[model samples]
Target: MNPSKTGLSFLWLSAVAFIADLATKYLVVTRFALYESIDILPFFNLTYVRNPGAAFSFLANHSGWQKIFFIVLAILISAMLVYFLFKNNAAQKLQNAAYALIIGGALANAADRAYHGFVVDFLDFYWQDWHYPVFNVADIAICVGAGLLALDAIKNGDKKKSEKKA
Candidate 1:
């Protein structure tokens, strides 16, 4: 693949993820009130909530400084991801896709923070009384991206070990 095509793939994937994240957030905000929960299954529900801090609502109870901190951090990370996407080899599709997903998710959440001072979250999961933190599409993408990267790293490590023995 040419660099242009590789770059386009990254951009397209990022756009899709970003759009999905934004669209889902809009629907949740419009269709549900803050903290409103609707049962969707035996172990899941859609609950509207907002987080002004990082994952799991870390620093959410602070006096409003964490929002700015997260926004800046996201921007920095996004810039680094973009740089890596462009500098990476065209053949590295897995890495490119991983970076794209992370970039998209980071930007989506950053936009929410910039506009509303928090990220809108709705997906909720629980088993009995144990509940997971509410999250949004962006958070899901980020997690999936990180998982892919980890898998790729393990594959590469195994390949190197095998090659060394050959």
Candidate 2:
């Protein structure tokens, strides 16, 4: 269960995700105006959006508290991810990848909040007249990371059950 071999790949993935997320956010902010949408597919589009709150703009309606709250939360989560990455011994491939994704996403959004007082969102998908909320690279990373971790946990649990029977 030693995870030393996976550490390098984890770090590399994290770095790549973080950098790419940041770079894309930067491009969105610098290249496109806020709330602008460009069609990308039959039901997808690239949109420039800024969210001051957490996912789905929960606290976005708040005048100012959202900035401080999201910033603090991102910092706390990022710190926890770093600790888990370096200490967890049973680092299954999915778990390791999950941590990297979470770290990168957290860092990317944090940077956006610090620089623009909000997070930048661009990807947009819709069906006919119904549109989904705009999201960005960071959100994708976080969501995928959670899924990977969940899958890893289930896989490991099944393995352990089989081992006990054997």
Best by lDDT: 1
What digit string (tens of lDDT, one per residue) describes model 1 on residues 12-62?
Answer: 778888999999999999999899999999999999999988899999999
The sequence of per-residue lDDT tens digits that candidate 2 reaches over residues 1-166 is 3556444358667777788888888888888987887888999999998888888899888888888778888889878886777676544678878988988898888888988898889989999999899888888888999999899889999999999999
Residue-level lDDT for 12 in candidate 2: 69
Candidate 2 lDDT score at position 61: 89
Weakest 10 consecutive residues, lDDT, candidate 2?
Answer: 1-10
All candidates: TM-score: 0.93, 0.90
Model 1, TM vs. native: 0.93
Q: Report residue 83 deviation for candidate 1 (angstroms).
A: 1.0
In order, the Cα lDDT scores of the candidates are 0.89, 0.83
Off-target runs (Cα >4 Å) in candidate 2 are 1-9
